[model samples]
Target: METKIQKWGNSLAIRIPKSFAKEAKLDYNTEVEMTIEEERLIIKPVKYKKYKLSDLLKEITKHNIHKEIDTGQAQGKELL
Candidate 1:
């Protein structure tokens, strides 16, 4: 498959085919890692580390204190 490098507002860009993108599971706003080697342009999807809420909360200590803000009246099961 061949694609054309077109002008994109003062920058040159290449359009990835929808079929290829779908096969590679690439979607809008997907982060990719691009590199050039031996005159070849390689684009790979960036693998981001997934973290759980519990893992993130463990990183927070007393050094960064997050104060709760009052959001007016309480509703349902909430204790005053």
Candidate 2:
């Protein structure tokens, strides 16, 4: 697809058509990775990393000394 670079604020940018953006599953504020291979330029969406809160909590508890604190004194002792 051919596109013309136009002035955008302080930087130059090419406007991707709505049809092309929709076909590429791109929306406003979407993050994309750009690269050049030989004479061709490529643009791809960046994938996000997925994490689970429960897994993170379990990992933290595995190494936590205060997770089994039963009393205020025990907690205070652990704190000190």
Q: What is candidate 2's CA lDDT for residue 50?
A: 93
**Model 1: lDDT to the true structure:** 0.90
lDDT of 2: 0.82
lDDT (C-alpha) at residue 13 in model 2: 88
lDDT of 1 by residue, 24-48 (tens): 8889999999999999988889998
In angstroms, give how far residue 66 of model 2 lies from its true place.
Answer: 15
lDDT of 1 at 54: 98
Candidate 2: regions farther than 4 A off: 51-80
What is the per-residue lDDT of model 2 for residues 10-68, given as tens digits with 9 covering 90 to 100?
99888889999998888999999999999777888889989999876777644564555
Scored by CA lDDT, what does every candidate get?
0.90, 0.82
Clashes of each: 0, 0
For candidate 1, the per-residue lDDT at 43 reads 87
Residue 50 deviation, candidate 2, in Å?
Answer: 2.8
Clashing pairs in 2: none
